[model samples]
Target: HSSMGEVWDEEMSSSMLGSRLRKVVQNYQAMNKYNVENTGPGGVASRPKLSGSELLCRLKSQVQVLTLTPDLQPFASLSWSSQLPVKSVTSELGPYKSCAVVSSAGSLRNSGLGKEIDSHDAVLRFNTAPTSGYEKDVGSKTTIRLINSQVMASDEHRFLSSSLYSNGVLVGWDPAPFSANLSQASWYNRTDYPIFTQYQRYRRLHPLQPFYILHPRFEWQLWQQIQDNMVEPIQKNPPSSGMLGTVVMMSLCEVVHVYEFLPSRRKTELCHYYQRFYDAACTLGAYHPLLYEKNLVKRMNQGTDQEIFTHGRVTLPGFSALNC
Candidate 1:
């Protein structure tokens, strides 16, 4: 078995809830471990890869905005509808020579990648990872902000009132129970949180800002694709917002320059660069299917291991220009 598999084996043995379940999961992983070679293409589109047009269609179709319910219920005090953004986001900021995806990982702490990262045509950051004081490391440019519903529903002071989220194109997603019934009514009834209500309120506060909630189907489709490609069956969770954001940028740019998604030799236990908390799970992942996701990313990356280890940067051809 490979080092990552070995590590996962050890981790799961101790952390998994029950013995029978752990054995079943491990057995499934072992079956797929050598089903395909590590050097082959990541499970993205099979060996030959999708043509640019097909790939474009697939990605574009998946990127959609969830329709919000007309009536504000439960959280009736907030003016949700009027506060929403002017319209759904319809950006085509792509076909560029290069772009950057700056992860919030603590591995980025002293990379001095600000100038290189800022030089890209566009940059994407996640959640509430700030660039104000950490500009020397993470850069100050913000072309996009991809957040989860937790970021939207929980922190009104930071997400709603702060000027930090005011500048960039905002995309948020809340998990839904079923992919088939992701309508406004379904979303109203089954959302993990009342993010739609909060979204409306935030929109009322900043109508001019471009804000869009991701279609629940798009998230599930992405998760499904990731699972189909993985050697091991992944946890039944959606891909992390970071992975989704990377795909979004790929569709919009010519070349996606990803930083710290694969971590570096300077990899630390810290969860995010802006915070001081520590956990190896932040890099290897516990809640997310992150280990499998990283495996796919490392396989698809056009850059070398030296670059990833030293600079924490990985280069990938954008989906807009991809032939496979």
Candidate 2:
């Protein structure tokens, strides 16, 4: 079972937890520093850092065409019977002028960003992060909810029953082998979590809800771009859901404002705004290539770092507007 019991030892005293937490942060910082210093001469200069223009050009060339939703025929091979194919998300929420990608980072706490977040034309939030009680921190508006396969498979009850998911556009993704090419057969067999059955079930129950599986290739393409552009080589893992959602919005909208994806002045170890639990890995990343993702975002960010620090906001020009 997916449990954080070992990761978060509840028996530890609060004072002890805080003391140990400092060491963990120190170790992570050292490791990250080593990774950067050992990479090449003069750190960032050793590897070619993509300028804003270059980064935008690469994103336009490599990532913009990759779609988050699968094609119609992908479901044909599966035994699941459906009279209608899964609807295209773009068809439902097409051509937004401005959008916001709201991250679940704890740095978002007390930033008073709710009104600004809700002001966008569309807002995208990650898996299982609630907006009920924390409306002041995280806006009540959710135009799109992006989830991973774990949420679809393990939390089927909530996913199927919750009114939270029923209101917004739902897009879920599962990781395939890093090099796996896009095909219904390969994707079905190689995915860490096979969500086809669950997806079919959800669609059948809520025919009106726009739920789509993000194409596995789209994820890998972004991963490749991240690796290619970063100063230091990143882990071979997939990009975080936050990064994926940002690119998704960038492709669909004209201007995308990403909130707290990169920790700002109010940065905290708290994993999410909804929970009191803290994990440095949430920001630094354990499984996903989040550190590199943050660097990439910072490189591409049009706004000043001061703005990012105080407001926890980064403004980006959409991929559609990039002149490749």
User: How far does residue 131 in candidate 1 sit from its true spot (Å)?
Assistant: 0.5
Q: Give one digit per residue, the lDDT tens place, for model 2 in 233-300.
A: 45556789999999888878999999988777778889999888988778767567676687778778
In model 1, the clashing pairs are 49-324, 50-324, 83-203, 83-204, 84-203, 84-204, 94-252
Segments in model 2 whose C-alpha atoms lie over 4 Å from true places: 1-47, 65-74, 79-92, 182-185
- The candidate that wins on TM-score is 2
User: What lDDT does the true structure give each of the candidates?
Assistant: 0.67, 0.72
Q: Give the TM-score of candidate 2.
A: 0.81
In model 2, state the lDDT of residue 224.
75
* Tens digits of per-residue lDDT for model 1, 1-324: 322211112112213535544544444444432122232233344445444345345544554433233243332344554454433343434456788999899989988999999999989999888999999899999988888888887765378888878977788887664343544455556677777777877877887777766656666666655565543456556668778888777767788999988877777889899998986667765556666667656666777777887788888777657664
Relative to the unseen true structure, what is the C-alpha lDDT of residue 138 in candidate 1, on a scale of 0 to 100? 94
How much does each candidate deviate from the true structure in C-alpha RMSD? Answer: 7.8, 8.8
At residue 181, what lDDT does model 2 achieve? 56
